[model samples]
Target: MIQIPSKIQKIIGNEKYIIDNVGMSGSSVYVFEDKVLKIQAAGSESENEYLMMKWLQGKLLIPEVLAYEKDDSKSYLLMSRISGAMACDDYYMKAPELLTDLLAKAIHMLWEVDISDCPSIINLDKKLEMARYNVEHDLVDMENVQPDTFGGDGFKNPKELLEWLIENRPEEDLVLSHGDLCLPNIFFMGKDVSGFIDLGKICIADRYQDIALCYRSLSNNFKGIYGRAACEGLDTDKFFEKLDVKPDWKKIRYYILLDELF
Candidate 1:
């Protein structure tokens, strides 16, 4: 059976109950009466999340941290309840037509956030080094790592792919990137996106890093939502074209593979 932290239970105090497990990591996220209490697995991720929430307080649509604590066995964060409509799941099921515009707006919002004041957020070079380390240490599952949309045979050598990425990386735009931007991370009410969540990976990076992942996610999850014939009608081809670069499939695959371990 899963254990709820005593401190977290105490904080919620008599609030009517429900517990929804939201993430796959070691952290345990429980949604009780709309509020969330996340208990990080001992030494894993509590500090980074605490700091991210502190820096992101008023700037983004994120849960406010109410309390934080760490003991020898675990660390926990109590946060304000997030009450909103569903995410991309219901949105695509109900009104698939709006996916394009919603995604466009999400991209715009990601690009617009100011990172000038963010401290301790990892920069692109560091992120690249981390990725390189993962590749070098055989941490990535190369066999299963392939582009989801534009299907390609898995790369024979991750080091070769990493070298290519390092040699031809796009000039960095240094925008604030969601780092893990995908449909599930976005919350929507009607066609408008209400907010974004799962902010632990937020960082400053090249604009292409964000765009590449977004493009791959949309292509993978909702390929049939917008039929091929509607390419012109939906104006999606134009939107993707304006992203101004082809996704480096190997690098995107490498990053996705690395994400699975983290």
Candidate 2:
């Protein structure tokens, strides 16, 4: 049970905040009535998300950063919660067609943003270098990665996969990307996209960086990869149709494999 720093709580005002434990591993998040407080080990991506949220304010529907405090060993960020449930919630999952349509729209929305002065550079080289650092430092959590990433059928280890990625770089199709465009990170309001959360990796990069991860998210959520019951009549082809793009399996696989390192 992590406690919010007293000095920081004074700024946000004392309101008995209820804890909302959500999101993926690596950070502890507490949700108040109107805000979310995320705390992580110091020198993590909290600063990146805070700055990126500020930069994306006018461009997209995202959470507003209320306050940020960092010490030598921890980072705390308080932000306003975006309205609406996760796009992958049971209600949205039941309406697979509408959810697919909204997801396509979300991808297009990101592509349409102006990136002439974007601050984050999430190009392949930059991302691959980070992957390399993780591999060399033994930082990757091997147990929870995609089942296929390591085994008799797949590459021997992260180093082997990194080598393959370096040798097989694809031609760049530049677009603004929500670097972690998984299902939970996106929120929905009715039939439209409400906002996106967990924006630490938001940057200008290949469109497939987003498309690949999002495709994987949909497959897992609808096809029962994450332990929830699979939704019937939910085919990814409908997603590709809504997205107005042909499937590029090679690029999609490449990006997904790259993500395993992180």
Candidate 3:
């Protein structure tokens, strides 16, 4: 059974809240009618999230931090909920043209953010360092990784993959990036982006950092990796088309493989 943290319980105080168990990892999230509570292990990213969300107050359609508290072990953040369904929800997924168009808009919107005073820097070196730490700590979930990333036909192990990433780093495009632009992290309301969630990794970094993950997410969602078949008219190539760029297969592959370490 899931346990609601005492801090969160006190904050909601006699109000009803629902614990979301699906797809949760390393953190616990509770949803009230008007607000959301996220509890996570106190870590560098936790601190990053608090500051980033607070900093992004009027810059974007994102959650507004109402309260935050950090103790020795856990950190809790309470924020307003963006009203909408997930972009990857069946209703949206079945409408590929709309989904693709909105995703394109989101990509462009992220690029438009002024990075002059961006608080976090998720450059390649920093990400590589994080990959190394996760590798060293055995924090990577190998089972959840791409099927071809391990076993007989793929890279032997995380160490080997890390070495490859180091040797083949791509040139940075330095833009404000979501760091993880997967569909579920995005919310949509009537063909417009409502907000972005999971801001811990938002930073100034290569644009492809967001692109690669987002593309993979699109493909996976269409391919039924999320447990449903591709909705009609789902065209994976439309992502790049909507973004107004040709696909850079090598860069995409590199970024996706690099994500395996985390």
Candidate 4:
């Protein structure tokens, strides 16, 4: 067990803690009664996540950062828990329509946040540079990636995908993006969006950044890919209709493919 620093230990005093092994943030989440303590490697994204959460305190529904500490080997961030269930809960999975509606509103909420004074800006050019670096350094994680992303139907490998993305980059429709907008990272209270979690990637980026990931997540979730309700033929158009934007499949595909590198 990783030792919780004294500051975070103080907040978690005598409170029974539960391990939260959800989401793909690569962090250890210790859930308490009304707080969450996330422990991750020192140089990982947790520090930036703390900064982003603090900066977004009033603009969006996000966890309130209470304490942050970093040592040579690990970083600890303690925050007030938001009241809600994950958007990927079994309840939402059974109702794809309502799920889509809430997710659409969540995307809109991210866009509506003022980026004039935003803390992070992860534009495509910067992302592409990082993609190239990841490829050169063999940093891409092959597991948990879209299976088709590299098989016979898709690109030959990560390098090919990165090259294709660079050549076919789409027009920018910038917004305050929830860098990783998968269902598990979004929360809801009833039918309303409650808060966002795993905000390490939150930044100013293309609007399609959120849309593409959410679309793929919805499609997979409804198809029982996560082993729940296998609702075939999910009419994903309802999502775009709710978003008030015509489906831009090209941009969507580009963004989805671009995400593979990260």
Candidate 5:
């Protein structure tokens, strides 16, 4: 229901343009010349995303916000475009071997970032609660609920799964997480990773929260990307071994399902 404003056209000047919904979220993204304009309907989520971007500017590969405005209709975030490569999808299709290594490196790099200075980011407990609420309120798509291999058949029941996750949430390790580190969110140029995008969920949380998601993605995308042999090659017990702490399998399962809904 949202459209680009006439003033936005004047602000960017007359030029050939392309508008694509670049993310899974309900946000409007407009690409003009060398800039990307992101606007979200008025809400706390939109405001948090804008704040995250403002906090991360120049610190990471995130695009720089040029201007922000809020009127009766919505809030807008204008940023300089990041030019280079497509997301990790092409690599997953053609060169699958690059998938695991690229993801491993990306996750490692994400862990390296210190988010202690960031303000206004949500905590993991709140995020997990939100996920549970979504399930209880029937806001989540039940048809999309797939059984988690790691949790065995116990993952079949959504309520039981949610309860288990809430009861067994992992201790917070307080590392900067991409929050949603799926393959589609990572950009790559050939075999090299360019950067990450869709950073609205960046936060400090248990390291395994991100690790578990990355592990699930790699396992799903490329069978045995971290199998026994691959684990030896990577010099760890695959993804779980690399984790500084063990993840709550139930929480991991719950989060993965929540990701599909998001």
Candidate 6:
């Protein structure tokens, strides 16, 4: 985080373009004619994203970082606009086969990134390290979870869930992973992938970390559980088929459950 000019402060609440899809990052995003600015509280996650984007400059279709600035409390990331629509856009949702194929391609691209000199690595152990802290500090968001993820039908609480994740940790197939690879985080131009946004959680994690999230995102989008009612709720079976990898339901469930902590 560097000392940036105060120019962004003036655009904070301006009407030019305020992206409402900031998700749960506790951040605000503003879009100018040709640039997108993300403002978030200063933290390592935010710092790591700045690093990862620089490192991936030529590796993937990602946003080009024009400027990264920090004040006493917040960090600002200003980058060129990614040219395309989000994977969750209604147009793509209605074309499930194309959507699944594009998502599978995105995963393959991330996995292809060489991890030899990767700057950030949040494999399972590292993730759980942070999970433990979130649990202890009550930082986990209970309200955003699935039904029965806690209490009666599920684990007693976040602590118990964290313990379960630790005790039942699965072997990992380490690869470059988009820690939060949901539909909205991906972008597409026509049938081709344009770029990926939201790099804070990008890391060399278990292959399953991304797979599970992608699956969950597809299901939610199809069922209309999120933005729109699911697109005839595209069958996830097709998604796994596109990867030509057998579904590891056990590990998928494990990783999804594990994400609850973060």
TM-score of each: 0.76, 0.94, 0.94, 0.95, 0.75, 0.93
Tens-place lDDT per residue, model 3, 1-262, is 2455576567788778788764446688888999988889998888988998888889987899988987788898999998898889998888899999999998888988898998889899999999999998988898789889987989999989999999999998899888778999999999798999998888898988889999998888878886677666777687789999788889999989998898
- lDDT string, candidate 1, 20-119, tens digits: 5545455676777767777766552467677877887877777788888877887777887765554446435345457766766777777777888776
Cα lDDT tens digits for candidate 4, 1-262: 4677797787778888899988665889988889988888776366668778889999999999999998888888888897889988888877777888899899999989889988788899988998899899998888868879998898999999998998998878789998889888999999899999988888899999999999999888877786576765457888899998898999888888888888
Between the candidate structures 1 and 2, which one is better when assessed by TM-score?
2
Clashing residue pairs in candidate 6 are 222-230, 222-231, 223-230, 224-228, 224-229, 224-230
Better of 4 and 5 by lDDT: 4
Cα distance off (Å), candidate 2, residue 147: 1.8
Q: Each model's RMSD to truth, in Å?
A: 4.8, 1.6, 1.9, 1.4, 5.3, 2.9
- Model 6 is weakest, by summed lDDT over 10 consecutive residues, at 9-18
* Residues 73-134 of candidate 5: C-alpha lDDT, one tens digit per residue: 68877777776555445434454445555666667777777776878555667876777777
Q: lDDT value for candidate 2?
A: 0.85
Q: What residue runs in model 5 are displaced by over 4 Å at the alpha carbon?
A: 5-7, 147-158, 222-254, 257-262
Tell me which of candidates 2 and 5 scores higher on TM-score.
2
Query: Model 2 reaches what TM-score against the true structure?
Result: 0.94
Candidate 2, residues 52-137, lDDT tens digits: the string is: 78888889888888888887888888888877889889998999899999999999999989989887777888889899999999
* Cα error, candidate 5, residue 28 (Å): 3.1
Estimate, for each residue in 1-262, the C-alpha lDDT of model 6 and write its tens digit.
Answer: 2234666544333436656554777888777766788888989889999999999999999999988888788889888889888999988988988999999999999988999999898988889999999999999998889786888779999999998998999998999998999988999999999999999999889999999998988887777886466467486888899987799999999989988888
Question: What would the C-alpha RMSD of candidate 1 be, to one decimal place?
Answer: 4.8
lDDT of 4 at 141: 84
Give the C-alpha miss distance for residue 168 in model 6, angstroms. 0.4
